[model samples]
Target: MRLQPRFRRPGGPWQASDAVLAIPLGLIVAILIADILTPPNLPLGPLLIVAPTMTAWFAGPLLTGAVGAIAVAAQVGAGVALGILDMAFLAQVLALVAVAVLVTGLCYLRTRHIQELAQVRTVSEVAQRAVLRPLPHRIGPLQVASAYLAAEENALIGGDLYAAVRTPSGTRLIIGDVMGKGLTAIGDAALLLGAFREAAHRRAELPELMAHLEQSVCVNLAQPAEGGEAGEGFITAAVLDVPDKSPKVQMVTCGHPPPLILHARQVAALPAARPAPPLGLCEMFSPEYFVDTFALQAGDLLLLYTDGVIEARNSHGAFYPLTERVARWPQISPPELVDRLCVDLLEHVGGRLTDDAAVIAIQRTQDAA
Candidate 1:
């Protein structure tokens, strides 16, 4: 059965909890009634602390305090009804209030910590947007869809990167992964993306654009660090140029995974015509790069992804069979295809991916001759 896309509404840091607050409050009332009706020796006053503590987990400090106050009032009334206005009953009431105050404060601190995390996630998302702008659903003669899964589950951006933009020559795109994860790789990705975006517009040839990216990385990597080697990192990338007027796609692979072309219910990996080294290490050996041109028919879908997807491992240590899995969704749209792949990938790996994964699906529309 085909899985439908699930839409989730955007929520803020201060979004209300889905739990019913009235249930806890009613339980507090029930506990007070039981204390008043039960035998004097039953001693149900201690149970009143549970009300405020429960509220603390799901509510703000003010609401927790309010619940605590109600609990304290019930305890005092119980003491009065039992005719036990002695110092012992007074001590019990004091202890209940103290517990309430402590629980309320703790809940407040927990809420604040969650809010801080939400704020951090928000900031990361904004930064990711600035670095990796949203890809268009339709670009020239293609229907496009892309997905990125960060290695850090909570992060909005990761080492895996992709971009697609229309140029005078054609619709140019790149998908790549840096050597490492976190901020440093993100920095490299941002550098590569910036270079690609700018150079794709100015350069007419695909190889020249690739050279521009390599030159940018070489310059950045050559900069001396505080205690590390100048050329300590490299990025594995694949660049594709789909001409606006031709039913052909040109590709250049740089120590990156070969792209998969899906057509006629089969997935074929498009190997580069000539091997090329990663972007940053071009200064070391000066490796030669070449573009491989493939026929892209109207119904053909071109998929570019990072190693994270292929290298994803299950409990049995088996890498994900992307080609085999992709065969199951031959008739789906580009967006649906991407969504299905993401869901299946996560399911194959037991719901958590250790590395960052990124994939872009571009289907040549029927408008193409």
Candidate 2:
């Protein structure tokens, strides 16, 4: 998926915030005038440092240095005007120059740090798109839309993941959340998604596909990670197979939240009759994975999401009402539905989520052949 573009000012180097530079420039002029008007003993040249220091806050090193030079020139002009080019006045000029240089150096460091941060964000976005490949907007008779949010500040992806593959007989979809948060969880999420995309096309049966995923997870967790113990993590996931000509969806819930079916004004949560254990912990329970079949009529929407959606809490500590909220917009398009739910979910949590969230809306657009 393409990452959203960040908002930028239309102009070149100078941004809208650069307009504030006028304040510091005006300060320089005021200080110069004050120094010239004041008595020779009460020089205001030292006050000129304020201009460059203030400029450093909004402008980069080059602009800050230029302002500092102007401040220094104004101090010299003040000295010449008052005919006080003595040791005392020279000391004030040197002090002003020192302060200006200090602030300019700090500005350079700040600008470099921001550039580095932008690079990291760009890399993370690339990784996110590669791992969670975008679901086709139209796959066979299904219309699909998905959204993902990371809990980590400035991160594009985290533990939550989702992907869809178009197979010869059907469309296979998976939405999952790894055990942890932040960058630590990305490795496991990528592993699961990679396994799904590769195995979805090869495995004809939903149970077989789910079994392969569980085995993949088990093998992955059994190996010790860098400085961490082995077999320490697990993932909650829901996998679905929607055949091109079938009027039903085959699903296997592995310790994940149930998918909700929205038809007209009704919202029904499809909980698996015999849900399997989460991928990595399947060995602890019966090895068999059961596939539950649910009717998916034309125009019916399937809502799949990670736990982050329902677990989102407001200021009052109440969880978000996903089913109730979805029932209100049952007839909306898949894209519109996903967009609305994402917006509402963020608002319910006061604009910051405590966990990584992923949501997918799939609508069956035609009847079975």
Ten residues in sequence with the least summed lDDT for candidate 2: 1-10
lDDT of each: 0.84, 0.87
Query: Which clashing pairs does model 2 show?
Result: none
Candidate 1, 150-223: lDDT as tens digits: 76856767888889878876799999999888888888899899999888888877788887888899899888
Root-mean-square deviation per candidate: 4.1, 2.8
- lDDT, candidate 2, 1-369, per-residue tens: 225433222224656677788998999999899888888878888999998888777677888899999999989987887788899888988999999999999988887777777888798788788877777799889999998887887777889999988898888899998998755589889999989989999998888998899889889988887787885788999999899999878998999999999887699999999998888885586557889998999999999999999999999999999999998885899999999999999889889999989999999998988
TM-score of each: 0.89, 0.94
Residue 1 shift from truth in candidate 2, angstroms: 19
Residue 335 lDDT, candidate 1, scale 0-100: 98
Q: Which candidate achieves the best TM-score against the true structure?
A: 2
lDDT of 2: 0.87
Where does candidate 1 have its weakest 10-residue lDDT segment? 1-10
